[model samples]
Target: CLGDRAAVALSRAGHFRGRTLFSGMLYAPLVMPEVITGLSLLLLFVAISAERGFWTVVVAHTTLTMCFVAVVVQSRLHALDRSIEEAAMDLGCSPVAAFLRATVPLIWPAIAAGWMLAFALSLDDLVIASFTTGPGSTTLPIRIYSEVRLGVKPEINAICTLIIAAVTVLIVVASLAAKLSKTQADNAAPM
Candidate 1:
């Protein structure tokens, strides 16, 4: 929800003043090193006297991934026809309603893509997770790394295999869905 709203706001930033600065701040994470990002988050948490745990990790991952999601959704938004939203607004819809009804449907695929990307990044993230995580909140990647330090085990191999299989299935399903959506759209178009 936060990522989607940020993407929308950033996408519409060009219409407002200070677009460059706003865009730069949002996109900074994309170019910043993961270690630096993690360190900064850790420092912030410490400064705020916030306990590092699952929630902190969640926040860290969200901060890291939100920019990526924004980039993906922003690209789709840029490619989208503004007139569809404008037409909705012209026909008595409020601006927010026009965006929700007209723009969101068109950008649904991008939103899904962004979600998938964020999930994948969070799942495998070790550095940021390490910095933000505390006792009783170990993530899969952190656990895997710790297990590997003692030596490669069959259980670890099996877990890795399962992760690979799951990711492969997700990719295949997403591709088929995209193909089906495209076919349906093509068929629905006027001759």
Candidate 2:
């Protein structure tokens, strides 16, 4: 799954020979909003929903989320060791098996981290969510935004504190796990 994700990200990024300049240019525009991304997404939703409903919003959100995820996973793939994969292939594994066994394990943590980052981004997205969501598809970010706009309250602070705590915990745990895995791998290597 990790290799697949990394590969998909690389493929989508238009990366060739491990280059990622194209992806950076593409995503840079998206991270900022000129006209409020929500309004743009809303316009797209109206045009598309002239054809369908519930799934349209999901599709839009997935596309939006995948853009960010791909950029992250592509960077992870680029940083990976190419020699390990070549060694796996030389040992008689097929290309896919080599990627699965050698490349995937090394990059799995990055891919998992990207997934969490993407999830957090998606959860916190408000403008896009507000524009793209149908009647029944309002997300947490959208809900919170709506409430805050109406007026600030104690619950908003509670929610903000919870979000901060969760993100901090995730970052700490992921860092420790990466450090531990690198130490164990280094120790296991023949010396």
Number of the top candidate by lDDT? Answer: 1
- TM agreement with the true structure for every prediction: 0.92, 0.72
- Assess each prediction's global lDDT (C-alpha) against the native: 0.91, 0.68
Cα displacement (angstroms), candidate 2, residue 32, comes to: 6.0
Write one digit per residue (lDDT tens) for candidate 1, span 59-131: 9999989988998998999899899999999999999999999999899989998998999999979999999
lDDT of 2 at 58: 62
Itemize residue pairs with steric clashes in candidate 2: none
Off by over 4 Å in 1: 13-19
State the lDDT of candidate 2 residue by residue for 1-191, as single tens digits. Answer: 33346455555446486356645544643575723655665677677654324465565556556656666666777787788989999999998899889987887766776677667766766656666667755677777888999998899899999989988998898789879989999999999
What's the residue-level lDDT of 124 in candidate 2? 64
Q: Which window of 10 residues has the lowest lDDT sum in candidate 1? A: 11-20
Model 2 lDDT at residue 96? 86
